[model samples]
Target: MGPFVRRYAMPLTFLGLFAAVWMVQALVLPPDARRAVIAWASTNLENLAVNPVGTMVASAFVAEGAQGVLLVVAAIGLFPVTRRFGNLRAVVLVAASHVLGTLISQGIALVRLQAGLLSESIRTIPDVGPSYVLCAALVAAFLYGHGRVRRLLALAGWCALVPVLLDGLLALEVAAVGHLVAMLAGGLIGGLLLLLERRRVAVPEKMAAEPVAGA
Candidate 1:
């Protein structure tokens, strides 16, 4: 039990936090107050401009849709990545992807708004969710998960998420664009981490071999 908890600490903590936030959103807050909380936590253009770090970090923990399904998907996606790469790397991969995805997507929206393409109302469109982080984890796990079962779980998650994530991609919707970018970012970051891990392992093996050869 101890080892199991240590191994899955990152995913377990994230899920716990997610559930707490879900409860607050669903049960504690009234509808009007819930909207206010979500708006405050959202990574919308106005919020991002005012408080980028807070909104980006807060947004990933707030769900805008079916929380139950998202929770399942998050568990499937996050655990494999954490088990494969350890907690720090898993967090880095997902968090970096989330921030990068948000920035790029919102940057595009800003450009469009400036060019008179998007409505002024987009500045406060209330974009909050865990989808970006979950998408990144799914991509990383699918590409680099250790076991067949882990990889299959990630594949299943991707299939379930693709329709929803890519729904308005052609129209360049903010959330859709963010999810796509987060997936790509996750894959790229995963490749880099894998390379670094291989090099770290190789160096130790090389050092050990050099001592044997000299003896």
Candidate 2:
């Protein structure tokens, strides 16, 4: 691979795919058609309860307006995180964050609905976005962030994005909590993966240094 591609393959691949889907939604489809498509593909409580697997994948690609663009931009900026932790670890962390975040938030909403704390309308409320994955990636980046300045910058970026993700609405306050849970989950998972990788590497090294049983 070329130097540029080697350095940025992850972000470029993700951004290209996301931009293609987002552009089709923005330019090709009419507003009503787009909304219908979004509704059908959303990971809201009702939709998720019905179609958990597909919506988890679909919903990550359904950002609205500038959201999709910003997600790609952020992905590019944080692409180093992929390099730092290795692509598999980064992808797993992000995927887990998105899936777990959605499940946790919707689970809480279900409980509230059952207790009459939230409106039944929440079951069908539109909940598609790249926010969960992005939030998780950001948290993982923070964990891998090296210097004091890098860590502070990662944290500042997260704080700035949280209100936008939750839309600053009082009713959706639980979402902020859900995002926090996802971030913490990402950090924990990232740490564990790193620990496991270290142990895996150490085991072979220790065996190589030890004398053979018969030799």
Candidate 3:
């Protein structure tokens, strides 16, 4: 148990936090209050302008729809990435993807609004959810997961998520754009991490082999 916890601490902690927030949203808050909280936490343009970092970070932890299903999807995506990259790198990969996805999608919305292509209401549209993070993790894991089981889990996750995340991508809908960006960003970052990991291992092996070669 201890070894497992240490190995998968990032995913475990994330799921725990997600579960707690889900419980609060579902059980503790009434409909009105829940809506209020979700709005406040959303990464909408209004909130992003006022408090970018807070909203961006908060929005990733708050989600809607079927909680159990989301949790399972999150677990399937996150665990493989964490196991392959370790906790810190996995967190960096997902968090960076989330932030990039949100900023790019919202930035485009802002540009369209300014150019009269989008409505003013988009500034306050509720956009809170963990979909970006999950999308990113799924991409990274699918591309770079260590073994067959982990890779299959990621593939399954992608299949389940693609319809939901890519629904409005052609229309440049904010959520869909964000999810797409997150997936691309995650794949790129994961590739970089893989290269770095290989280089690190190669360097040490080369150094160790030098003495033997000289002898």
Candidate 4:
């Protein structure tokens, strides 16, 4: 695929899926059905314990109201990474960020509960959205982002996202805390990937320079 298409394919796919789901939610599903769908797609500690894999993937594709709009904007920021690294990495980065973010945040909640900082009722709080993965990828793209424009766009996203995360943390919301943790995870993962890429290239060069074992 061409560079432009390679970069855009994943985001386009996401947008297409988003449109389909939006329509389904708006036109087809009844209010109760819609609520049921949202519940099914949620990836809270309770839900993850039951259907860990399902909620992770399902949550990514399910966006509602303002979240859908925010997701589209985040996807736009993520396109540069997709173009540079291809779709597979884009998906992996987002998925890892969301999953790991969920795990860590939930873990924190558990600790808080044990310490009496949080209530047992909080354990079942439904947490679903693209914020974790979206923040991670967008920040990662910025970290490894090529060119001034792409980096700036990444920065713009950071400015917008970080405040929300901070607000969430300040408000003692698990979901917001998860988003912040996930964003950091994304940045760390992006940095590690860059290092790994460098090492990968260097290893081949080192091998070429080394004498053959048989020789």
Candidate 5:
């Protein structure tokens, strides 16, 4: 039981729970509820669309999840990455982080810290998926990863294209806050993954030369 919990069950549990929650909250909200929420969010989205003011509180909340997941991914990619806490720890940590983020986001929304109705069509929508995505890039860079670092980076580079796509999708309309939240979450997650990995990864050439030169 202990072994199973640590090895496969933990990570699987975390990923599974996270995927389910995100699907329900971000992707699969009740249709009527989703439409209403989207309508409200789109308003603030427009206000920041053109002259872009600031990120919605919800985006910041989502950023927390991105941070948490990427942090764990970075840890996993650590060469000596220890599974000291086992898979349970990793699973719990990521799951808790995401859940906490959602709670915070909802709390803020309830309080109306967000932008209210914008022009006619402006709306705010939270796409919290980017957090996991950028973390996946980190997972690629250091760990066995899905592919090589270059490929992961190529994936990270997708952020650049996102704006263009959003532009087209919006008809050059504004969802500035919504996209800002996405970009901010994406950049932060990717940057941290790289930074943490760099700090931990050894400079093989440097280490090798140290011994040769000394000898």
Candidate 6:
């Protein structure tokens, strides 16, 4: 197509792959099987820790792995580089970040797995850790460095985590409404910050032609 199309193609493609994989896992894997797999992986090799041995689980694991690798590529894409470098960066960033996020997520999952093994009902608590670090890296590298696209994707990404955490909190019998409210609160704060950040980033050359200005 055009330069604009080419610029985003790699990112879009990897994202699609990542989504497909996660969707398969979420749609296919059984809860019990998923727990068992997580248990095995936690006590043994980190590599083996993926639970839920169904087709969907396989798809999700592969997708998460791909995302981890792609994240690093995306980070490198932030630097001043040739067109090839931009594409290369996109791939690496997506994969690397996904891996980091997975590792963080696994750490949290391990606790639940242990609970399962012990016949306890305890589950893991939510906090910003390795997974957040991975996500932060992806966002910072893209928004803080390259400063592109109004950072909506970054903000939305964080917001998405809220819903997942809300579901977890609800399962734990915490104030379910609180979790939802927390998401709303976070949404507001995150939105404001992104808006401020968007103000500071240079309007890229490619964006200059727009009739309506983009933040």
TM-score of each: 0.96, 0.85, 0.96, 0.86, 0.33, 0.36
Better of 4 and 6 by TM-score: 4
Per-residue CA lDDT of model 5 for 96-183, tens digit only, reads: 3333433333334433434552333323444333343233333333332334654455345444445542453333232332333333
Alpha carbon deviation, residue 146, candidate 6 (Å)? 4.5
Between candidates 3 and 6, name the one with more favorable lDDT.
3
Writing each residue's lDDT as its tens digit, candidate 3 over 115-203 gives 99999999999998888899999999999998988899899989987998899999999999999999999999999999999999999
Question: Which ten residues in a row are the worst by lDDT in model 4?
Answer: 67-76
Which sections of candidate 5 miss by over 4 Å? 1-15, 18-30, 33-146, 149-165, 169-193, 200-215
Error of 1 at 60 (Å): 1.0
The backbone clash count of each candidate, in order, is: 0, 0, 0, 1, 7, 26
Candidate 2 structure quality by residue, lDDT tens digits, 119-181: 878888777776777777677777775566656666777877776665633564545656766
Worst 10 residues of 6 by lDDT: 121-130
What are the Cα lDDT values of the candidates? 0.92, 0.74, 0.93, 0.76, 0.38, 0.40
lDDT winner, 4 or 6:
4
Per-residue accuracy of model 1 over 124-154 as CA lDDT, tens digit each: 9989889999999999999999999889989
RMSD of each: 1.3, 2.8, 1.4, 2.7, 10.8, 12.7
Residue pairs in clash, model 2: none
Tens-place lDDT per residue, model 6, 2-23, is 8765776665554455455456
The superposed Cα distance between candidate 3 and the true structure at residue 84, in angstroms, equals: 0.1
Looking at model 3, which ten-residue stretch has the lowest summed lDDT? 206-215
